[model samples]
Target: MFGVLTERQAQQEERLLDEEEKIPPTSIYNLELLRECKSSRRRWKFFCVLVFILTFTSVAQLYLSLSEFKNQLLITTLNRVKSAELTKDIDIIPIHSHNDEWRRLPLYDALRVGAQSVEADVWYFDSDPDTIFVGHNKVFLSSKWNLDDMYLNPLFSLIGQNNIAKRFEDENVSTRRNGIFYNNLHQTLYLYLDIKSNSEKTMAALEDKLSPFINNEYLSYYNSETDEFVEGPVTVIITGNYPYDYIVSKSTRYFFIDAPLFKFKNDEELAKYNHSCIALASSASLYQLTESRRALAGVAGLSEAQVDTISSYIDIAHNNDIKVRIWETPSWPVRTRNEVWKQLITLGVDTLNVDDLYAATTFF
Candidate 1:
């Protein structure tokens, strides 16, 4: 019986040993939990590294884009400055101030604003040949507004005061200075005298008034015998009822005639008028040239046909070394006037006839 009891106790002890084997120790469970924590920490570290790389790449790309934009802006500003410098060095475009006598200051005002040419309408009063009145019509005539007082005297004063001859000599060795502007020593000032009365008497009066300038070699003249043109400070061009025959017949003349643009149908006709010898320029009505193109008016600017016609006239005149001027351009609605001015400039018009001197000077 004692032996049976011992065996039973041994069996109970064995069962206890088997239960211990099935269940894990506290230290072993702790080791498994620590392994899982280490794996989670490694994954977290990898995720942080990926995030850092992406953020670094985005920042670097943004910096490069900003740097490129900065470079482009700098280049644009530099180009604009260079363009302005180039424009400043170019010559002032020739401008013709129409009806200069009607202005508030006459010739003086036009010269002050850099107008290379000015027009004066002269009416010869046979009653007094000594006095050449400057006016658009007889009604606006005044004794104080004579050609000598309004134009000649002031010109003489300005030329002497500015020492134009000396300035020109110092600057240009070969070219002669003509215009009243001191800064520009190469341009010639065109004095357009439109005669409104008897051509014979008017010519005499004009010669008398211009004798001082002609004598001083300040007036441009043509010597028929020598076939040479003597350029001077001022070029006198006669238009509007000028005696063409009388002018062409002269052996030596101090004044040039403005040839009628419409009469010159071809090169032969242009030469027939002695355009190269006697005429300084040709004048035509701009309205007449654009009449056919009126249908295309403001929409497409000037038509191809109109451009060709205008260009042909310009070509003929330029071929003979003659400048072409078109007067009576549309003046109202400033935009249209500017457009016309732009077109004329683009077409290479030598002299622009403008009422608004300031606008024309600034437009370029």
Candidate 2:
């Protein structure tokens, strides 16, 4: 019985020891699960942060792009508005660039289309022996075309077909003359011719050809030799190339002064020489006036002295009932150009030289 009891006790002790040495798997599983949960939370947090940064960056870039687009649109709209306003205010049209196609337009159409002055660069090209033609440039060199064919022929034909308008009269160009064919509108044509290279003989020949036009009673002549400008009958427009002492012993209807202002010694000299002759001055020198007002006088090309020289020229001419005109100015950007125009208007500059027909229409 004792042996049996001892064996039972040993067995119980061994079972107890074994039970103490063994751990529950559920507890270990819970600890490991807790650690994994922590690691998963960390990874989720990192992913969320990365996503947030990417989303924010994307939004920022999108916003910037949209802002830039809006700014560009606004700028475009503003430019368009300014252009429209300028076009509305000015009666002139702006030809984008120099084009010979404008020559085909009727004379009256020129004014209506906003051309301040129709400029014809007259050059005689020798196509063959004894055959000369009026061409704008080297492009139109055929004998079939001449100045007469380019301008006068079309003008005469149009007027001949339409008998309602009267011929050009010297009184006021604004008036509607008979036999003048104005395209739909009653706009008159203003001719600004750049005489091509011609010698004394060629000039004489040109004069003879032009004599028929000159003899018409509807034209006006301004004799630069006499400094007498009248408004009646067609006459050869003369230049102020001679000394100022000469008076228009003969009557003339129109006059042009190519003289520079400084050519005269002083105000009195200018006054004495420019009596009763419509005058024009070069504006090539006035470009720098905007940069510095004090520097206005020193500007090159045509100095203030030259500009001031016109003061007397204008006085003498206007006092004798002649008009004064000026050439050259800031011709682009109607806004900027208008600044110059306003200044000239204040100074009583009659004609504003402009290359764009659209721009001229705006001013007139």
Candidate 3:
């Protein structure tokens, strides 16, 4: 019994020792471990903040780059459109017969060189009353050149053909006829005829003198035989004292008023008077154009103050179906072409009056 009791006590003591070995002792973390854990957390937080900053900065840069590209694209498109607009504007203005000042320039050659519009200064001359020739700047003397030879003949030669006198030449009929009415060949010629002495008497005499060239058929068609000269088809724009009313009434052609009276202070009244007729103004008379608004058909010679005035005129003209032109602005390259061109485009100045259209196209 004593041995058994002692065995039991030994087993009991062994079991207690095993239980104590299995159980872990209460322990506190050291400052180093705690500091290490805190440091690791701080580092993770810093890494996350760095990632956010990098992402935001990258996104911002990309957005800015895209915006800049878009702006550049917009600017380029606007400029291109503006340039095209200018070209179209120039294409529509009357340049053919109006450009007599450039007669020294080969007419056909000038057309080839892009002489889109032209001007003709017509003077009514008479041998009577001391031989006064009515025109701008009375510098010509009767002693200088005969009316028939110097001016009228050259114009008729152009209007007729290489063989205008040969009444039955097919070449004259075809080519010359084409030149009289169609395309740039037959261009819209402005006759700035100054009435020297007696306007009616001079006109009658001049008409008789130009009998061969002045006919409904000649005025109307390239092919005179089959084509009846359509009345109101006269492209010769006569300025000065020519009776436009009588001309249009008698014929089917229309005329543009070259008078400043058309550009009156009360533009509205004048515009309403002749809706069919076009009104012309110098750049100095831009105010008249502005007030008249759509009533005024068109304007010429835009001043510096009239740069912005172009937009206004264009707006009104477009609204009322009118055209606009400018003179003495871009003839000389006082400045760069692009600069002048841009201004013309922005303002909607349809025609740029250049003494040398070829020189003007170079700027384009």
Query: For this target, which candidate reaches the highest lDDT against the unseen true structure?
Result: 1
What's the TM-score of every candidate structure?
A: 0.69, 0.46, 0.47
Candidates sorted on TM-score, descending = 1, 3, 2
Error of 1 at 293 (Å): 9.8
Residue-wise lDDT of candidate 2 within 35-63, one digit each (tens)? Answer: 99999999999999999999999999999
Which stretches of model 3 miss by more than 4 angstroms? Answer: 1-99, 102-112, 125-135, 143-152, 162-177, 180-202, 220-234, 240-256, 259-268, 276-305, 318-322, 330-333, 336-338
lDDT of 1: 0.75
Q: Which ten residues in a row are the worst by lDDT in model 2?
A: 233-242
Tens-place lDDT digits, model 1, residues 228-303: 8888778889999998877888888887888877556666768765544688788787656656424246644566
Model 3 lDDT, full chain set: 0.45
lDDT of 3 at 253: 35
How many collisions between residues are there in candidate 1?
A: 0
